[model samples]
Target: MTMEANELRVSESVPVDTGQRRGTRPMAPDDVAAVGRLFNRIFRRHDQASDDDLGRYLQTVFFGSPHYSPELGSVVHENGANGIDSAILSVPMAFMVNGRPTMARLLCAFMADGKAGAVGAARLARTMRAARQDMCFSDNASPVSADHWVAGGGIVLPIQSLEWQRSFLPLTAAAILAGRHFPIARSRVLVGVLRPIDRALRRLRPSMRPKTEGECRSEAARVEEFLQCASAMLERFAIRPAWSPAEFDWLVRVASMNRNLGTLQCRKVVLPDGRTIGAFLYFGKQDAAATVLNLVFEEGRERDVAAAMFAQLDAEGYAVAVGMAQPFLMNAISRQRWLSFRHRGYFCMVTRHADLKEAAERNDIYIGGLASETWSRLLTDF
Candidate 1:
């Protein structure tokens, strides 16, 4: 069957709520246009995308995925005017828990229109959490959304929510950080003025330089090669994604499409004998901050992997390197004086299974990177 026809059949299977003008229902292919409008109204008000563009994105991310599950599909709230005012985008994922295959729902890009849809939004969130999936979680939640998740019996993971940064050029990094809030700081003239100061500061603090003395070296890797390295690195974790080769390829391809973040770079750290010990992925650009997407290493190889990754970023002229702080890498990050940590958002999860909940609370399970919603273009693209 054609993709559109398959989607329509999936939508028809879901029972519609016709009793009320304002109610939540399973999001269908037909709802993409309205959901796109609602998304722009809430998250992209200043720079709204054309309906056609948004429709294509929604289709690719939600409907086109091989993992899409109708029972755990996205949800939309209908207003009195038969229009959508609230939405919660969900991407179904397969995971391995204690050697058993489990399904999960990764929530992303939630939105509600002003006061009119506030309650509806909350209800929609609750609806998603209450789905039949083994677990539901999000790593890109705002403080408001975090509170809602907590209120709905979800646990807020303190460790997974923190972000770490290592600055190679302090002055330039500061300006780029400030640019997020002030446009003037991002001006070419201001950036040009800071560049020289950053050069002097780097020379003044030789001890702060990222260490590159490890015997391991990073080699550019294809997505499939990274997956092989990742599989070896993540086997120790009790609960982790169990994506098929095709699903993983699709995920990485979608992640690479976020041009706003810069070019996607993937590399595998290997020993002198060519044994792969680690792998890292990130978006990098010259004179700008590089955002790490996933960084995994074998036990006790954190320092080697981290050193190689940062050395490469520094050599590429990135002013700073940042990513979600994984608990296992905390010691390596702390040893570097140039690296710092900051709380960004809450990584919250909801699950009835006690083992899964405890494992997550103790930081035994992996939660960020491919497991989270950071790969979505909706976050970085207009």
Candidate 2:
């Protein structure tokens, strides 16, 4: 789902596999429920949301938003009663490519059975690439999807994953880390000892407390407000996604459907003169872990907004937080001593016309939590 540079040209073509019995076809309006069932069956076990709740959520994910286009999406047919085994949903996104307004596809809902494997995945991946012209990319690729992406001519960008931090509940964070490294650390005594130490550390540093704001305090905000905040924050990079009101509305609405994985949250920082200087959209996890999906602030005043947001989270009982390390938000997050981690998967992309892969590596373009499909679909289950 991409438009030509400097012009809005939507392609009417839908890609179909020429020779395979398990050929690809565009997603039909009626297929919404089946898509929901398939996705729920695949992800519901690990996902925290209830089955009925997730089905409703999936409807909004697949078709409820304005970002969807049947022609730009693809599904694989099988011998099953529904004749469908897998799917890849596409969102037609607007971008600032080479300093011009552009459209691209951020692929979503990519799933296939183990039986489908690379063969089925490769066919579907190719079909998606053919659906767009400007570019086709995904930052939420699973290990299997990453392989399929390369098989279809996409290149994975070498950028590192975001920085993450543990604050109040450092014991739980430490326990989880230790459990991963060695099973012996999973003991009641270890937790009991560390709990006291963590509390002492908090008491020693009064500055660790989140501040209460009179005017610029955190409050509930709409998705539109979140995007308005995003648009106002100019890019540090040369290229970035330039979304329209409609697109932002759709993305934010979809993003708010966090299911039970996390509570969808928006925090706006207003100044004394009644001006909104910054805002952020985040996932407040059920386990008290806050993941900042999108953070927008005025260029020179990023740290101020960030400090206010963190303070608010601290008051709300959030013990830990994580965020993508976009350069704009680094100064704010780094001040808290957030540790960096390797990106889990690839920032896989492919484009016939421009050097999208090169641009991504050179930091000439922007791709982060919100621009990718991770906020709504991928990270929700985690």
Off by over 4 Å in 1: 1-22, 46-50, 129-133
Q: How many residue pairs clash (N, CA or C atoms closer than 3 angstroms) in each of the candidate models, in the order given?
A: 0, 2
After superposition of all CA atoms, the RMSD between model 2 and the true structure is 5.9
lDDT by residue for model 1 (1-382), tens: 0011122222212234665445676788988877887887788774254477668888888886677756667877776565777887888777887777777778887888889887677666556442223688888688988887777667888878998988888888878877766868867898899889888877888865787657999899976777787787888888888878978878887777777778887899999999999998888866788989888889998998988998888888888888998888888777776788888788888876778878877888865787787767787666
TM-score of each: 0.90, 0.74
Q: Cα lDDT of all candidates, in order?
A: 0.77, 0.62
Error of 1 at 74 (Å): 0.7
Can you write out model 2's per-residue Cα lDDT over 1-382, one digit (the tens) per residue? 4523322222222334553234456667666666666666566544232355555655566565565565544454443333556666666676776676656777766766557433545556556553245677777577777776676566666553444564655765566345534746645577657766766777886655655434565667876787777775756555576867876767766776666437777888888776887888788865346777777778687777887788877777665666666655665566764344546556677665555556765666666666776566544442
- How much is 274 displaced in model 2, in angstroms? 5.4
